[model samples]
Target: MAKTTTASKEGMAIRTKREIIKLLKQEGALDALQLAKLLGLTGMAVRQHLYNLQEERLVAFEEEARPMGRPAKMWRLTPEANRLFPDGHADLLVSMIESMREAFEEEGLEKMLEIRNRKQIIQYLSKAPSDLPLKEQLEALAHARTAEGYMAEVIDNVDGSYSFVEKHCPICEAAKVCSGLCSKELEMIQQVLGEDVDVERKSHMLTNSNRCVYSIKPKGSAVL
Candidate 1:
């Protein structure tokens, strides 16, 4: 049986890491093979992820005795990780709208007056050129998204799939419904490509103590 845990939304820079924490929080502990099989990732990939998580101080492991080999490392989510994600509420756009409403309430018509300026602020600050490689562009966009409070993380699956993990949903958390943050995320994704890129949304947090595996298969290449 696999142990599970719920990952909090704090300190979890990526959605994948958050989902992994959630799994570890709920399930308790999982071996590498179990993590690989459950999350649909290769063992080596899983190990790399585990190492990263460990470095973040989000996960710990014990050397468990095996039947015929040396003791193997079994990973577990720490309490700190559980505390980070809090509840799995993804109120993305709703939160954004609520924030806008609050600002409007305080600023009144001034809010409307400031909207274009705010837009200009972001447009001026965003220096992501369109000439970079798709991967590089994605990384730049991911950085921007993270700065804007999306908890975005970019993963190069090494298979050609670029996994963008959304860690926070201010709208979802605030409005509870009537928000299509996921759609907006997809739209941003489309802007980075000339042709139709195979952007897939796993609809899972990448942080919670559990593995949320995804691949980026290159164009005309076999999917991993």
Candidate 2:
């Protein structure tokens, strides 16, 4: 077995911090209390770390104006802090992917590659029992992927069509590449559908970037 290098660990740590940084970027600002709650840590603990972050100019806090009460400070990323984070999927997706990566004790690179492997998807969904209807089967597939840290959602596109969207891609932003996550998603979808399905992606606005949406035409639905 090869010994893991220090750089690998550091990379994961940065990825983890970047994960937090991603959230800050999304919310645009958060007070120490909010950060503590979001991270499930005590306010003091978050404050301690943030103190150093402030020194490094990665974060800054300012007292907010309040009526009839002491002003509270809100924490937010500085311009420097923004530079430290990778521009990846929306913060939710980044956090989810990072959480899953840590939970599996796997390197982010390896985890992403494994998830993208076409065969793995086919094998997993193949385990679903055929007795379930297509919608139920699709939900099962989405839920399974969600368990793996992907924010997967299936939306009814109406007229008997379904839209499949993967709202996060951890590897995409890290590597500045697509990593074919969408392709793998489509593959699993086809396996579940058991036939050619009309699928297309829609134009999306921010607040949820890097999301993949596929419009599906389920079998035997007359509406186009």
Q: What's the lDDT for residue 25 in model 2?
A: 60
Residue ranges of candidate 1 with Cα displaced over 4 Å: 1-126, 205-224
In candidate 2, which residue ranges exceed 4 Å CA deviation?
1-118, 126-131, 178-181, 203-210
Among all candidates shown, the one with the greatest lDDT: 2
Candidate 2 lDDT at 148 equals 60
Taking every candidate in turn, the Cα RMSD to the unseen true structure, in Å, is: 12.2, 13.0
Q: What is the lDDT of candidate 1?
A: 0.57
For all predicted structures, in order, the TM-scores are 0.43, 0.43
In order of listing, the candidates' clash counts read 67, 0
The lDDT for every candidate, in the order shown, is 0.57, 0.60
| Cα lDDT of model 2 by residue, 80-184, tens digit | 553443334446565665676667645664556556665665665665444577667667767776666555667775587777666543344433333345555
